[model samples]
Target: MEIRKATEKDVREITTIYNEGIEDRIATLETEVKTDKYVMEWLFQREKRYLVIVMEENSHIVGWASINPYSHRCAYRGVGELSIYIKREYRGKGLGQNLLLALEKNGQQNEFYKFVLFTFSFNDLGQGLYRKMGYRKVGVFEKQGIRDGEHVDVMIMEKLLG
Candidate 1:
């Protein structure tokens, strides 16, 4: 398996992997399946300093991670929000860890001082992975939002790069 920077050509496969996460209902609150065109447009507007990486095996994308703006204010310029998703079949194989490590290193190199992410409270696997990766649970937002007609709590995790 090879982990490399993602390009426009990889957006379709990335969208597939992301949609899998969306369908699982455990990874994200988003219910609508994303389209390649929509993903491509988002990718195009990504902050130039941040990084987007993909894990590929046999020329097929199996996972992806990205660091995006945490906020628009210049005071928050050193912070970024992280997102990672691996194809369901590829979970528990350290792919998420590897992808996150890459994103963290790349983000730090690009002057980001912090990386933050949110996970559903019930997603033990994801929380465990983030903890293993050195991310600390900053807080939990109770009844953060409603998804699929159920209220869900979200755990906020953060890692300082300094």
Candidate 2:
């Protein structure tokens, strides 16, 4: 597998992978499935302004990772909110780790000083991956999200780049 920057043309595959995360209901609180229109717009904008990486194996997109703006304030300029998603069939294969490591490396090279993320407390796999990646739990938002009528805690983590 190879990890590389994503292009606008990748929106379709990216959207598919993202919607999979949505359907899983464990990675994100976003319930509305993304359409091509919305995904295209986001891809275009982030393409110029953020670190978006994709992992390909045998010429097919199997996973992706990105660093999104954490805030608009000047004080938060060096902070990025991290996100990662691997196709369902690709999970637990270490592809997600590779994508995230690539994304984080590129972010640091681009001057990002820190990475931050929020994961549903029940998402054990995600939390484990983040822990393995050297992220530290900074705080928690109790009952921050309700999915299927259950209150889900959100664990917030951060990793300062070297």
For TM-score, the strongest prediction is 1
Give TM per candidate: 0.97, 0.95
lDDT of 2 at 25: 92
**C-alpha positional error of residue 41 in candidate 1 after TM-score superposition, expressed in Å:** 0.3
Model 1: per-residue lDDT, tens digit, 1-162? 899999999999999999999898988889999999999988888768867899999999999999988999999999999999999899988899989988888887899999999999999998999999889999999999888999999999999986
The clash tally of candidate 2 reads 0
Native-to-model Cα distance after best TM-score fit, residue 134 in candidate 2, in Å = 0.8
The reply for model 1, stretches above 4 Å from the true place, is: none
Q: What is each predicted model's overall lDDT from 0 to 1? A: 0.91, 0.87
What's the residue-level lDDT of 107 in candidate 1? Answer: 87
The candidate scoring highest on lDDT is: 1
For model 2, the local distance difference test gives: 0.87
